[model samples]
Target: MPMKGLIWFRTDLRLDDNPALLDAIDKCDEVAGIYIFSENQWNDHNESNVKLSFLIKNLEILEKSLSNLNIPLITLNTNSFKSLPKDLNNFSVTNNINQVFWNNEFGINESKRDDLSAQILNNSNIHVSRFDDQVIYEPGILRTGQGKPFSVFTPFKRRWIENFDMNFLEIRKPSALKKSISLNNESSKIQYSKIHKVDIDLWPAGEDAAAARLSNFLELKSRDYNQSRNSPILDGTSRISPYLALGILSPRRCILEGMKLNNFELTSGNKGICKWIDEIVWREFYRNIMHSFPKVSLNKPFQDYTDSIKWRHCDNELKAFYEGRTGFPIVDAGIRQMLTEGWMHNRLRMVVAMFFTKNMLHDWRLGEEFFMKNLIDGDFSSNNGGWQWSASTGTDAAPYFRIFNPITQSQNFDPNGDFIKKFIPELKDVSLKNIHQPKQDLFSSSDYPAPMLDLKTSRLRAIEAFKTAREFNNS
Candidate 1:
């Protein structure tokens, strides 16, 4: 009789170099995998339907992959972790499982779920093991000499590069979970009779899809990524973020491919390709931030003082901003792109975030939640960090006085009405310079909406708010 274990899969959907999966296979005998769809958690976090669609598609792909080893993926339809312990315990006992294993997640409800599950398993006399697979280095692993989390990205990124070793990326083949176990081991398959209707046109899932995307990015567009990642008018981006967000592609695999290209001492693409890896490292950084200050995922700002700042309420203008009727071509373009495609360019994310929080004098949290509702690539930490950074209310956020001029940003990045025209159809007939500020000349009134509010006036209002806060705090 082999020592049986239950491998509970969470964010880490792939088998390649997954820390928890590897650990369980190393220590346990027959390993049975379970992926539970917790609607309770998704509702609490406001996850988009696109996200669920991706999960189901990836889970299906994972099932096919698991079938290769004759292992069955048992999906459990549970509402919440409050009763998961009792539920999982009964199932494990019936299946004759001896251990439970899973990876760590750093969200509020996620932590609760893991804690409740662990406590339940502990009482049942079953050993439980969990691993940190999401981020390359845990939060505390890399800290300043005074034993504190660094707010700035520069010093942290430098240390990350210095500390990373080549051996970490070596392909790891995990121990087999009882080599001959078949899908027939489970008495029956868990069913989710009432799942949301999912259309996966936006984000495709699986390890193979992830790998192919990486190959396409590296082969075709990587050379120009450094220059073209910012331009919405051009599609020269490495759009592997959705896959990376879902863990269909492991960071180690991405780093290995980048390193292989970067080590090409003679190629010019190496430098830009390596720079792309730094963006991947930024994801790790934000994940670690959430890990250290779990309250962030609980909807708290990184800076405590920011909580006291009174954000303006301009429901009418904010609506204009979100609907792409702001009359600023660049800002409007980003907003429309998000509404239509459920994703925006990384550069545009920064710009539109700034326009809303800084120029419109609106709350960053509102924009953050809106993005979560719409963005296909929206992760809690990254989106929160992004919105906060733009609003000057987060760790390493821009200075309160420094605000992005929407017109200037459009002229600099878009230069033409190409990206703006794609989303804001009314601006299709407007000229390049007029498109940047269609409301100024009243040129696009026939089809497009007018400017919600003057930019300079809004910018001054934002400044005044910050100045008042500064004076009050000083007093």
Candidate 2:
């Protein structure tokens, strides 16, 4: 009998640099791929429609790619993760798969689902193998001298650099199997609710498109990344997050390409290249935080004391913030950008998140969920990590008192207010001097709303709230 293998596709979607897919190809005579999607799972996780649309498009492209390798892609829909194990087992048994291979997913629910699938498969005499394709290191595997997971990013990054080996980034392309798998008829078309307002054209699907985007960024813009990344107007940063989020591209591919540009220097090279690589490391650090601290995944703040925070719940304020009419140009611009484009600049993300959590005095969880609901590249770890950092409620969080003045952030990052004007067209006629904080008369004359609240007072209010929460925790 031929050795038939099953490749369980998850977030690590691409064939390139995918150890699990390569392993299946190397060990089996024929292989088939399965992608199990759950609408209930997406809803529970607050997944964006834009992202789901992107996923479906990418899967279509992936199906064609796999067909070229003589591996058919079978799409399955389950109600939720609870049903996935049985679904997986039935498929394997029906197909007579002798082995199952998959890349690891680190989320709590994902881990649990994988565990159940593994147990079920092992009991059925089907061998299961998994590999890490997302990060250079498996989450929580790296530790500090005290044997605890490092919460601080700089120290963690230092350790990541020290332990890095070039061999870790090695990739081998898998060729077509000698024999073909006749499972094309079993492949089902993916079904998704299309409700996104974003222009899908902004993000092209497939690994080839992803590779081209990376190449363009490295060739044309990486050297100036340090200077231009902060500016929202400049296309300084690589817009590859959507690709990275879906595993259309791998972190190793990103780092390898980046390092190639930097002459293979991990830390020392063009300042821009090194800084860009640091952002990728930061993503891994957050993943480690998610794995090591399960409470974060449970919707609990990493800092226990933050539980005492008395977060305000106001519908009106939230509505204005959501609609991008908070009268804060930079904040509004950021919100509007995400609403229309399904993505936001990193610097603006921090600025907008800080304004929402600190100045608006709202719950960080709300803002975090909103981002996940709208962003095309909403990686839970990165979104949660960033919101918690802004709200001063998670590992390596900003100091409670270090609230950002959005106007100043606007001046520093979007000096010409071009980004603001581009997103909030009502403010296009507003002068540069007052664009960040338009005068009441300008707001009265235009459709743009006036500043909703006094920044100085709100800043103080947020600080006091944090102080009171700390005192209450201590008492």
Candidate 3:
């Protein structure tokens, strides 16, 4: 019997630089691809409608790409991860697949599903193979001097650079297989709702689009990225995040292209290029945090002491923040940007998250969940890491007392207040001096609300709460 293989496509939606897909092609006379449609799983993870829609579109393109390579794409529906293992095993057995391959996903639930699928497949005498394509170094590969997973990013980054090799960036594109795989794969349109208000056109689909975006960013804006990245109005940051989130682009390909511009140096050369690469490594570090410390994946704070912090719950405050009427122009602008674009500038994400968790004295989990539910480019690890960092509840978090004043941040990053005006049209008429914090008279005239809370009082309140939590933890 000719060897038949199955490739389980999860986050990895593209073929280029996909180890599992390439390995399946190399090993089997015939290959098929499988994608599981689990709406419940998506809901469990607080996945955004925009992201789901983007995923469906990408899968459609991926199916066509796989067809050209003589592989059939099969989509299976399961309620959740609990049922996925059996469904996948049945599909493998029914199709007489001798081997199954997939790239690793570091999330707790994903890891469990993959493990169960492997167990059931192995029992049925089907060979199972897994590869790591998400991170240059597998999640748990790099560790501290004591063989422990490094919890802090700076040390982890230092270790990552020390262990890095230039050859790790090399990627191969798989060619068309010798023979075609004939299978009854679903050719119907994916069932997805168009409820997301985000303009999907903002993000072009497919690997080609992703590669083009990266190329354009590197060619045009990368040199000035270090200086311009913090400015919300500047198109300095590479918006390849959505592509990376969906696996339409591989990190290896991104780093390789970046290195080509800077003499192939990872840590040295242009400051902007190096900084851009650091962001990629930060993604890898978060994956490591998820893999090594599973508690974070379970919604628990990495720093357990933080759990004692009493987070205030106020429906009016949450609603105001959500509707972008929080009266803090900079913070509201960030919220409105996410509401409209399904994306927010990196600087604003920090400012908004800090204001939510610290100034508002709300739970970080609330902000984190809201971000994931609205962001088109949301990755669980990155979003969670960012929220926890801002909340002072995660590894290498900002010091509890080091709260960012939204007004100061606004003045520093959005000095011209163009970003504030662009997203908050009610503030368009406000002078530059009052753009960051409109006067009461201006708010009354424009229908913008007054500042919800006194910044100084709220700052003191947050500090006191953290101190109380620390005392409780120590006691």
Candidate 4:
């Protein structure tokens, strides 16, 4: 009798180049895979509808692929991180399995779950194996001369690129069907999604779809990415974030696709594509940061100095902003887009995040939590890193003094107001010049609320608050 194994699928959904999956196939004569819904994890983490819906759809596609490979997916409805081990063990013993395998996730609770699962499985002497698949490099892949994690991005990026090569990014494809062991195909023991995910019309699931999105972005839009990425109206960005977030697409494959578009002669054309690749590296940077400072996932700001800085509990104002009646066209547009589309452009994410955390004098965590609740592409590291960057509360943040003026950001980024017009129909009648500052008009939209607070006044107040906090610390 050969050793049968179980592969627990978490965020790494793609079949290509997964180190854990490859290694599992190599060592086990038979392998079965499962994906647990973990409802509490999603609720506690504030995962948005778009993300939730997208994940379910992706899992369905994943289930089909696994079925084709002779490994039927077992959908576990368990919610608690502590509940995983016993649930997995019960299945393993019933199925006569010997080992459990999975790719490791590094978030605070995710790590806890992995730890508890490993221990419980060990008690039963079921060998558990995990691997790194999501990131091209692990947490300490690039470090300073002192072996400390790089706090700043420029030097970190330089070191990251220097160490990056194609081989390290490679993942093995799905094993051939002939190699799979026979399974009980007739019995419908597991629960399958009866209703199609409602919002899935917006995003297609499956590995093939992820590949197509990558190909389309690299070939058609990537060269113009530098110029268009900031323009909210243009298809400047890859729009593959949902795929990336759900792990339907691999970052390794993303980098390879980017390299295909690279010219390396000048950065504007082919160079622009390389610059877009920098965004992927930025995602890697946050992951590395989170890994280095486990406290980040524990609700501690990357920069602890922001702790003494008092954050206002402006629930009414926060409610107004979240409802997309912020009176700043760009900010409102971004929020409205989020409500309708479940996604926001990368540049607009920065602008709205800064405005909420700085101009509104609200806590960055509040805004970060809101983003996670609303964004389809929300992931812990990226969302937290983005909000902190905008709020000037991060490890490598925008200088507190260099705050983004909402009106100027709108005019500069959504110059034509097409993105604004798409989300905010009340501003539809407003001209481009005044569109970004529609609140400057005598309360234009009866449907939309006026500016919750004045920008300049709030800006000064936030700066003073930070200065006062820092001043007391120095004293």
* Local distance difference test scores for all models: 0.76, 0.93, 0.92, 0.79
In model 2, what is the error at residue 218, expressed in angstroms? 0.6
Q: How would you encode candidate 2's per-residue C-alpha lDDT over 63-92 as one tens digit per residue?
A: 899889998889998889999999999999
Q: What lDDT does candidate 2 reach at residue 16? A: 87
lDDT of 4 by residue, 1-475 (tens): 9778888888888787677777777788888887777677677888876677677778888888877777667677774677877887777777777888998887878888888888888888899998877687877678987888998888888888777666775556767444555544223333323332225666687788888888988888887887888888995788888887878888878887687566432123476777887888888888888888888888888877787888888778887888888777789888888888778888889999998888888888889998898877888999999988898889799988788998888878877888889988877787766777764546444465677778889999999988987887788
For candidate 2, list the clashing residue pairs, or say none: none
lDDT of 3 at 457: 97
All candidates in order of TM-score, best leading: 2, 3, 4, 1
TM-score of each: 0.92, 0.98, 0.98, 0.93
Residue-level lDDT for 121 in candidate 1: 82
Residue 3 displacement in candidate 4 (angstroms): 1.9
Q: How high is the lDDT of residue 387 in model 1? A: 88
Residue 184, candidate 3: C-alpha displacement in angstroms:
4.1
**What is the alpha-carbon lDDT for the whole of candidate 2?**
0.93
lDDT of the structure predicted as candidate 3: 0.92
